[model samples]
Target: MTRADAPPRPENAAAWPRLAVVALGLLCLTEAAKLVAFHQAGPMPRASDAGAYWLLGAQVARGDVWMAERPVAYRTPGYPWFLGAVQAVCGHWAWCTAIAVQYAAVWVTTVLTGWWTWRVSARPWLAVLAVLVCVLSAARASHASLLLTETWFTLGLTVCGFLLSRPGALTQSRSTVAIAAAWCLTWLTRPIGAALLPAWLAIWWRDSGVGSGGTRWRAWPPLVLTGVVLAVGLGPWVVRNAVLFGRPSLTVFLGRELWVTTFGPGRPTAGGLPSTPEAEEIIRRASPDGEFTDWGGNWSVSNRLTASGLSDAEADALMARVARQGIAADPLRAGLRFVVRGIDYWRATYLRSLTDYDDLAGTASDVRDGQREWGNRACHRFRRAWLDAAPERNLLVVELSAALALMGLAGLWLAPSRRETALLVTALIAGIALSTAALEYPSYRYRMVLEPALIVCGVSGWPVLIDVIRRGSRTL
Candidate 1:
C-alpha cells in the first residue's frame, strides 16, 4: 500500500492514554501532602508497616542489617537501600521524593502496559483500557505513600515482561542486556521475581524464538548474559545469607508466613486469612496436630522461636518443615486451600489502606489490624483489613479485577494468537500469582505485578468469547 493509497490514520491516535497518564500523575501528586505527616512517625512500633521499613532503611544506611541478633530475612535490601538514599537527599520529607520517583515509574509502567497490549492484540481500545486500569489501581496509589516494594517490583516485572514479549528480543545483544537488567532489579527487590526467569526462557524457546535452526543458536548468548547478570546482582545477597544464616538464599521470611497461612485455623476468605471458630474446628478435623499451630496464633510462632534459641535461618527451616508436615498430614485440605488462594489471587481487588495514606499510624490501629468492630457497614479498605469506609471504590475495583481475570482467561485460551504470546503472558502471570498464594495469605497487594497481563489478556479474549457464544446459539 503506497502512502497515498493507505487508509487515513486516526487523529490524535494516542490521546486517551496520554490523558489517562496525566490524570494518574495528578492523583499521585496529592500524596505529597502526607510527606510531612510521615516524617512525624517516631522510630518505634506502630500499626503502619512504614515504621519497620523506616527503621530498617536506617539500619542499612548504618551498615547494620542485624537487629536483636536476627538477620533481616523478611525484607530485602533494595527498598531499604533506596530509602536510605532518598533520606540522604531529603532529610525530613524523604517519602515525598521517593513516591515521586515511584509514581513516575508507575506512569511509565502504565504506558508500557498499553503498548504491550497493542503489540499483542492490535486493538487500540484494549490498549487504552489497559493503561487506564493500571492508572486507577488503588494498590499502586496506596503503596505510593508508604515505603514498600510493590511499586518497584511492579515496574520491574512489567518492564521485564514487556521486553520478553518484544518481537525477536532474544536475538539482539542490547535487548538481552536490558532484559537481564530488568530481571535483576526485580529479583533483587523481591526474590519471587526469580520465578519468572524459567517462564520467560520457556516463552522464548517456544514462542519468541526465530524459526530457523541457524538463528536458534543465537539464544545461547542471551542465556549466558542472563546468568551473568543474576550472578553479579544477586551474588552479594546470597553470600550474606550463606555467612549469617547458613542459607544460600535471598530471604527467610517465607518460613513464618507459610507456617501461619498453611497451618493456622483461618478460613479461606477472599481478602485474607481470618481467624474463626468454624475454621478452628475444620483444622481440628483435618489433623488434630494442626491445633498446635493455632495455640497462640502468630504470637505462638515467635514465642516458640525465642524459646527454641534457633538462629533465624534455623527457625525458618524448622517452620518450613512444619509447613510441609501440615501439607502431608492433610493434602486434600491443603490443596483445596491452595485453589481458593489462587481464586483470591485473581479476584482480589486493590486495598487502599486509607488510614495509612493519612499517616495516622498511631491512631488507625483498628483499621490497620482488622481486629476492631466498626459500624455495621465496615468496608475493608486495605490489604487483609476488614474495615476502612471505602467500600464503594473497593467494590468497583473488585468488579474490574474479576472482569479482567475472566477476560484474560478466555483470551489466553481462545483468542487469536501471535505465536501464542498471549498464552505465554497468561502462564507467566498465573505462575506468579499462584506462587505467591502458596507463600502468603490472599492479599490484593501482590496483584500489582499482575494487573497488566490481566488487562491485556482479558481485553483480547472477551470479544472472541462473545462471538463464540453467539455463533453457538445460532447453530442451536
Candidate 2:
C-alpha cells in the first residue's frame, strides 16, 4: 500500500507582534528620512516657547536654574533639565541629540498607541492602522525635531495610559507609584498635563477594590497614598513659589496666558477693539516695539514690570486684572470666543497648518519639495503646493476628517471594552483643551499631546464601517 499522503506539517506563521515590530522599524526609518529633509531645508528658529526652553536649558547647563536673576517660576524644571543635559553633552551636536531622544519618545508613543488600540479594541488590524496614523501625522511626528514639551508630554500620557488602561493595573502597588511618578513628571514638563488628575482619580475610584473582596471604604488608603506621593513630589516647587512670590504658585504664567486671549491674537475673538492708549503704554513699556505673541517677548514685559518696582506676583496679577477687565467689558463676545476656541482645539489639523501657518509655509514647502524627490511625503496632502504660493486647504484632509468624525461617533457603542479608557482619555484631552481655551488663545502646537489618545479612539468604530462595506458588496 502506498503511504504517500503523510500528515501535513504545522505552519510557522509569524506572530503579529513580530510583524508589528518590523512595520514600526520601517515607519521610523521613513519618518527619519522626512526629518533629514526638513533639517536640510535651511534653519528653523527656536521661536516662541522653543526659544525660552532653549534659554532655560542653557541656564540649567550652567547649573543655574534662575532666569533673569529671579527664580524660574515661569516654567517648571522638567524640559529645561532634560534639554540642558542633552546640550551639556552633545554641545555642537546638541540639536541632533535632542531630536534623536525625542524621536525615541515618539517611537514609544506610537507603540503605545498601537498597543492600547489592540488591547482595548481587540483588533490587531485596527492597532496597526493606529500606529500608521500616529506616525503619518505631520504635526505629531515633526514635534520631535523641535525642542518643546510635546515629545515628553506625549510619552508621559502614553505611559500613563499603558499603566492605567489595563483591567487591574491600578491594583498593583508598583503600578500606582509608577503612574504617580509618570504623571507627576509629565505635569512638570507641561503644567497643563496635570489635567489628567481628575480622570486618574475617577479611574482609581472606579476600581479601587484593594483586593478580591475588600470594602469600598477600605480602598481609600491606596488613593490617599497616591495623592500624597504626588503632592509631596510637587511640595518643593510650591514652597519656593510661596517664599518668592508671597504665596504658593504652580508657575506665574497663567495671567499672561489669560492676557493673550483678551489682547493678543485673541483680541478679535474677545471684542476686536483697538488697544486703548493706557494699555498701549504698558505694552510699549513691556516690549518697546510691541511683540506680544512670542514666548520670550511676552515674558520680557513681565520681567520689566518686576524690575520697575513690582514683584513677580504683582506683574502676573496686573496681567490677570487686565485680562479680566477685557472679558468683563464684553462678556458675551468673550464667552463666544471661549467656546469657539475650545472647538478650534479639536478641529485643527497639523498637516494643513504645517504648510500654511505664519513663517512655516516657506520652509515647509522646501521640505515638501525635498520629500517629493524621494516619494516620502511628510503629509501626503502636499503634492504640488509651492513654497511661496497662496495658502490653501487640503481637501483630502477635510474629507477624511469629516468621515472619521462620523465613524468615531458610531464606534462609541460598538466598542464595549473601551468605555473606561475612552472616558479617561477624553477627560484628559478635553480638560486640557477647554481649560486653556478659557484662559488663552488657540494654537495647534499645543495639540501634540492629544494625538496618541485621539488615534486610539479614532480607530474604534471600524467594525461598523467594515460591516457597512461588506453589506454593500453583498448587495452589489
Candidate that scores best on TM-score: 2
Locate the minimum summed-lDDT window of 10 residues in model 2: 366-375
Model 2, range 1-476, lDDT digits (tens) per residue? 34567665446545765776677667656656654554333223455566678777877777775343446567877898897898778776665567667777777787788888878777677787887776556555555656678789889888887778888666777777888888888888878877887668657766775445768875775587678877887777777777777668667778777766765554344343235654554565565655544432346567777776667677787777766777777887777777777766655544544423333323332222111111224432232233232121343563466457446635543444556766676666667777778765555556557667767767865564575566742321
Candidate 2 backbone clash number? 0
CA lDDT, candidate 1, residue 293 = 38
lDDT of 2 at 80: 88
Report the lDDT of model 2 for residue 21: 63
Root-mean-square deviation per candidate: 8.1, 7.7
